[model samples]
Target chain A: MAERKRRRALLRMGAGISKSARVADRLFLPVVAGAALLTMLLTVFHRQIQEIVSPSPQPSGEQQGPRADVVAYTVDKVPISDPDSPVWDNIPHSRISLADQSIIKPLKLNVPAEPVKVKAAHDGEWIGFLLEWPDSKADTQAIKVKEFRDACAVMITSYPSPPEARFMGTANNPATILHWKADWQIDIEEGFQDLEKAFPNVSVDMYPLLKESIRDGKPPKTVDIPEFARVRLPGTWAGNPVSQLSKASPVEKIVAKGPATITTLPTQDAAGWGRWRDGVWRVVLAKKMKASDGQAGEMVIERGQTYSVAFTVWFGDGGDRGSRKNPSMLHTLYVE
Target chain B: MPKVYNWQIGREMDYWYEESRPRRQAAAVFDTNKCIACQTCTVACKTTWTSGKGQEYMYWNNVETKPWGSYPMGWDVNILKMLGPQRWSLEGERYVYRGKTIFEAAAQSERVLGYLPSDLDYAYPNRGEDETNEIVVEEKFYLRMPHDLWFFYLPRICNHCTYPACLASCPRLSIYKRPEDGIVLVDQARCRGYRECVQACPYKKVFYNHVTRISEKCVLCYPAVEKGIWPRCMRTCIGKIRMFGYLNTPEKADPENPLDFLVHVKKVGLPLLPQLGLEPNIYYIPPIHVGNINFLRMLFGPGVDQAIQTYNKAIAGRDLELVAALLLNVSTDRIMTKFKVIGSSEVAGYDENGHEVVRIPLKEPAVVRPFYDERLQVYRHNIT
Candidate 1:
């Protein structure tokens, strides 16, 4: 009688388990179909959903902007400071996201965000980078009051700290900054811009200091003006490198301990050129692999070594300048 | 951001840095009622400091005809538009600004709410010159106190404020305020030609040099001030409308100091746009003849009504101390720290060292000339 009762309970338990399993099997197809529909909708409205979710589009996971790593390929005697060199065609490019600089004083939080395509190459003697970014207008003139010039810079630190450290580095860990300005490129391509060049019809009675250069009842060229007259320009007289009219290269080497302490290195060891074509700026910045003796604030480049590199961009038409810029996070630059 | 007390606004306001007052604030009081707009101060400043290659458009000192005139094409109106509508409330005995300052109204990207002027904006340094509040073509035109149609000359210079917008807005910390005299200046060597100072200054005093590709402004003639002399603009004012002295805070107000007497005791002098929260060192005695109190209020703050009344009393010879203060303007090149009315006829000024710098008769003695000059045998057409 006991054995018969136990058999009856076991049979009831088996029946209940079978019924629930069958029900679950029946619901499985619809659940898969619903999940597929939800995924399709999400993929179709991905951009809209991102806009709703984030104030700024995050450049992550194979986005068109910059990635986390860049490899500097070894090449033999690629033309230094030439963005249009044919060698760039053979090299792979990495896209860099231009992040808004919202961490510092006089921040530029709203940037015309875009991806900057970059290619890095190095011979044994020199390391160079070619950066290409989009800008609707070519603003190469900063001589006017409201005009600011398009510019880009590359910062290379020792990569001694974590990636979360200051992009420009701190006082203890200094970074070497190579800045290329469009206005400086213009100065090299064309002659130095002066007040007379900006306003063709501007007239003045006389610049008494420039009397020695004035002739034929016409104003003298900026180059013709003597040193005595140039002293009147307090910036130039005070040895400010930014105010210097003549330049052998468009790029200037600057040393910085964070944003507030950016000073142009007296011995500039960088060279660059920038060209704006078809609403895009392609710039090449080059630096020596090793600094000459007594050359201060220069980063030494070496092969088979990794260095942390970052980028900063300024869109001139948007009035981007100084601490107002778009900066990127640190990326490992492998010099192979 | 730190909150600092702005005595001009009679309230605490947001500032980039902490409250740091100079040892002796270099101050000046301009009697707008007496200014003739001869451009003497402008020329003096031009020849003294800004006569250079890239400084053609710079005017450290400029006198504009008010109600429509601006040196940099709508500098005041443009900033005012950005600042939007502001209000000043009379709380107890002081007027408190209940509006946002340039620093407070700034966008997230900037330290101050500012706009960069175009090159053409400075092309017309004297645009709307001599223009009145409105067209004066009524058939029956009559002059009255606070006239139906009125205009006055407004001379401007760098205020060298206690909290300078230029100094606050500099990203690289190129601009500084001197600890000795509160004179704000741009260190040319450190400036990278960003022109942030040019955009930040509310008065549009900071100027950008096209040739040099850097920004420059009025230096307040520190070289002259270091030697206890007045700035070129103040000393060369032909109208005798400017008084240079060391001003103290209201709590440390010196009754005998000319700037303190005019600014604190009599309250005849008022700061330009005190709502901006710069605590500007320069003060202007409002024009009593201008009819629109609202217009005056916008430029000189809520103190215009009382300032005009006090100015009218001083002009009427009812206020001897105020009259003596005005008489001492341009009396000597030395910066006068103290002044006194000498009896009924004379006023005396003392320099920083307590030495009497100047003594001038309040009223010049006039002698009538004969109708015909006996020596030249000619009839005098004009006689004083």
Candidate 2:
């Protein structure tokens, strides 16, 4: 009887182990499924996941355009300087085709479909435009000719089509443009000599055109002295009339019409700021709507008036700059 | 594509496209005889530009063993196979290439001959030519073979051709030869990584950066050139076999200039492949009897034999200025627009503006080291 009881006990123990094993097998599938679901969630909300872990500021979602009648209004309570303001969240959006702008038709296939988000506000004296877009790269620096920087321009023109002007607007239409440059911002934040700092071993002598002396041969050994004045290559050097080397500004006022016709305005009142976060760029451009002495271009905004506005964007990594830029057709802007 | 004239082939050859000439251009020549395959030029170029992500396969400056080696692995062989055997016939002074150029190979809408090389194919560079198997005639004499293992280092860069196929192949018209320097460059803002330029370059020079998704190649170090400095490759050479200068027309070429003297006078430097009709600005001083003569002749056209003979004669005659100019003065930063032999001791180099760049002495400098002596307590020169 004792041996039989012992046998029965052993069988019960074995049965218990088998039952536990079956239970574990049943639970394994759910565990795996849960893990896979978590991974997928993490991938979808990667930006949010980063924020959750780090607990820093988070960028708001994409902005939505306002109704057709809702003109840009003056704001004192909401922040106008910050491009990431929630106030911009209520504004309308326009998705421009930068890819099709390619001169070569076949090249358009590679361009990504993206749109530019914009919002406008005024403090009576200062007019502010907040622009945002998705950019995989920040591209805040450019030192070499091949390296490019992200840039944005806002073209504002007077009503009634003053005269014939190209897309940039002509002297007759007189579009007052506020251009924001990421390169110029970086130049202010750090310096273009950063590349030199990175590649400290590779030193180069300044070019003859960069030198102040009127002679040529070997570059001067010392930094304080000049080696040569300028280079006389056998062709016409048509530099961008609006740009000059060894200088930088976050915002610039320019006017142009047609090719090779851009001229930088003398005004220094415009100011801009830009920041890239989580594959998106937020930019703010602010300038006085009225001229200092009360005389202004036809683009001067007035209450209850309608005006034309155009936009151009350069995706630094997308190879958009100069004439090769994503341009938008004229859009109506109500100055409320 | 329209029929146009190409003078680079030394004849009124037909080109499939019409392109306006650049005002002028910078040119180069490499003396392969002195090359040790150190790859300093390659390393310098990589460090300067191609050291970014997605540029791992790019070698703006490369050196491969001739008749045996090629970058993009088998680029020459592959193209040759596709084009078939190129035949040429001499008509009076001009020789015509019967084979199709990249332009001629393409359809009317296409600007150049384009073939997408598999990504795996770009992995290997400088994969040289296979050797001839030894013949066993009656006995085991492995030494005697007609096509033996003959090879020499052939360093290459962008030809910056008078008629660059890369420039023509770009549908966006972004690639341009600068009117100032004739340096062909793809505008950074205008390019959209189509790899058309990569497909068009017969030399397989232009590389596509997968990360940047754009085409990039040698810029000829224009930034430094504008400053009157030698390109990093020429400046940092282990062999001193490189020369950088401008190519002028026959009427405009400075007679005293080292470039003109070697190209037109001595006839020692020849273009790598003139039959392509691209009129490449880069020149090469053929390797000295080190590789297959017929193969070298095919590449450099008819100039191989004459170039070798002239180089030998110059070396034998102890022509100091020619030798000095060919070797260059490593100690100075002067660009030699022209060279002159001064007496028996030195060769003088001048810049475009009549400024003396360097004065390289034919004789070696004697070193006098000062060492302390225990007994004499006097310093003396130690000559090696």
Q: Best DockQ goes to which candidate?
A: 1
Candidate 1 residue lDDT tens string, A55-131: 23234323222323666778997567778889888777777777677777788877566778777888988888888
TM-score of each: 0.88, 0.53
**Counted clashes in each candidate structure:** 3, 9
* Collision pairs in model 2: A64-A91, A65-A91, A65-A92, A66-A92, A207-B227, A213-A229, B68-B128, B68-B129, B69-B128
C-alpha RMSD (angstroms) for model 1 = 8.0
Candidate 1 runs further than 4 Å off: A1-68, A212-222, A293-296, B368-383
Give the Å shift of residue A79 in candidate 1.
2.1
Q: Compose the digit string of candidate 1's lDDT tens values, residues B1-384.
A: 999999999989999999999999999999898999999999999988787767889998999999898988898999999999999898998888999999999987689989888877888988878888889877525878888788899999999999999999998899999999999998888898898999999999999887778889999999999999999999988899999989999999988899999999999889998888899989999998888899989999999989888878877889877888888888899988889889989999998789998998888888889999999999998878
**Every model's DockQ:** 0.58, 0.02
